[model samples]
Target: MKVKVNRHAAKALKKMLEEAGAEGKLFRVYVTSVHGDHAHYDLKLDTPTENDEVVKSDKEIDFILDKNDEYLDDIWIQFFHVPNEEWLITNPSKGGHHHHH
Candidate 1:
């Protein structure tokens, strides 16, 4: 699996981790639920579980991905602050047909 975290997201996540006193923990990115061809994710600071794959990004962050999730390949995570503060995690390699409501 390939995961990329943009600069904004990386900065925000680092600050959050520091505030939460979660330094040194891996950034865990995993599927919380799946609907049809779409999946919802949960991000947290956690220790590595058995068989978990670690993906390093931004030279200072480590992302934990499930070794079994092939659908997460080529995923991009972004932090947005224009309309509102939010995290956008998407698979750009997939077909751009996600319906938002």
Candidate 2:
């Protein structure tokens, strides 16, 4: 499994992880819904579980993904500040559509 985080998202996530009560938790990217070809993804602060795979991004942040989920692999997590502040999670290997969070 592989996870990619943009610089902006890395900074934002790092800030989030530094918040109160986020000590030992890592970011978890989960599938919220699955449409025919693609899936929707959401993030949360969580710990690794038996069924999870902890993938480290180039930004040095670790993400938890389901080991058996095909849609969870090769995910790209991005953040934008221009038009609006939002989180965009996409999987190019799947369908490459953006899901806002």
Candidate 3:
């Protein structure tokens, strides 16, 4: 899976990586029940030794999917501040935070 990281996201992620002295880890993207209907994702520093495929981005690292995550095909990750200091993961087709009924 490919994950795009903007300047803010890259800087933030780099800080965490530098602190741990770990590099070349993929930016894992997946769906969890946290958001319901595969809306939630946990993007953190994952080591290559732990995963099979690791994608290194110009600005960030992206993890290769074990299997195709069709829902994540167009997924984009960005960092936000005014809305609050957090990573904003979005699915252009699904919209935001609305639980599936």
Candidate 4:
């Protein structure tokens, strides 16, 4: 299991954590639902539960991932600036799926 967080995403996430007073909280990325081969992502600041994989980052943040979710592996989080500023979460392991925003 691998999770990569880019610089832009790390900065943005730091700000979010600071603003929400959620420092030291676990940044959890999980599969909210799965439709066929596509899986949706959900992020939240919460406590770690049993059977969670902790991903390491450069900053003082804790990333908790469920060990049971194979679909959440190899996740790449990046901030895009083409059309607008938004966070794009892509799972290269899961073929491809178009997301309309």
Candidate 5:
């Protein structure tokens, strides 16, 4: 798993992880659901995980995954604004997106 977290995303994630006492844990990224042509990603900060396929950015607290997500190699997560302003996650490789705005 090779997870890359953008700077902004990293900052946001760090706050959440630190509060949960998961600072050193690598953020685990996985596909938790799929609807039609889209795959929904789930994030977890697991401790001393035995999984070697997970990748985390040294500059941020987010992950890029290989654990059952090898097919999503080119998957990109982007945050966008909509409605009253919210972050949107997009997966170009999967050909669809789910708005969280």
Candidate 6:
């Protein structure tokens, strides 16, 4: 499993982790739904379970992913603030279709 976080996302995620209640928790990227060749993903604060793999991003933030889900592998987490603040999660290995959150 691999996770990549863009510079903007890394900064935003760092702020999220600094929130008062986020202590001891890491970001978890899970499958919300699958659409044949692609899938939707969402993020949450969570700890690693036995079935989860903690993948470290370029920013040194850890992300929890399900070990058995191919859709969870090679995920790219990005954040943009130009048009509006939002999260864009995509799997380049899957098809590179952006899933917004």
- Which model scores highest in TM-score? 2
lDDT of 3 by residue, 1-89 (tens): 45566788778776766775466654566666444444766565555453344555656455554344555545566776765777777
Poorly placed runs, candidate 6 (over 4 Å): none
On the 0 to 100 scale, the lDDT of residue 85 in model 3 is: 79
The reply for model 1, stretches above 4 Å from the true place, is: 58-60, 96-101
Rank all candidate structures by their TM-score, best first, as comma-separated numbers: 2, 6, 1, 4, 3, 5
lDDT of 1 by residue, 18-97 (tens): 87568678787777767777776667788888878888775467788888886566667788788887887776666432
Task: State how far residue 33 of model 6 sits from its true place (Å).
Answer: 0.3
Candidate 2 residue-wise lDDT, 1-101, digit = tens:
99999999999999999999999999999999999999999999999989999999989999999999999999999999989999999999998976899
Model 6 error, position 66 (Å): 0.5
lDDT of 1: 0.73
Q: How much does candidate 3 score in TM-score?
A: 0.63
Going through the candidates in the order shown, the clash numbers are 0, 0, 1, 0, 6, 0
Clashes of 6: 0
C-alpha lDDT of residue 69 in model 4: 90
Candidate 4 lDDT, 12-86, residue by residue in tens: 888878875685687788777788987777677877888898887545456888988987787777767668887
State the lDDT of candidate 6 residue by residue for 1-101, as single tens digits: 88999999999999999999999999999999998899999999999999999999878999999999999999999999989999999999999876898
Please give the range of 10 consecutive residues that has the lowest summed lDDT in model 6: 92-101
1 or 3, greater by lDDT: 1
Query: Candidate 1 at residue 29, lDDT?
Result: 79
Model 4: pairs clashing at backbone N, Cα or C within 3 Å: none
Cα lDDT over the full model 2: 0.95
lDDT of 5 by residue, 1-101 (tens): 33344556656676777785765776555666778888777656765344446454555444646555544554544443334434445566667665342
| Clashing residue pairs in candidate 6 (N, C-alpha, C atoms within 3 angstroms) | none
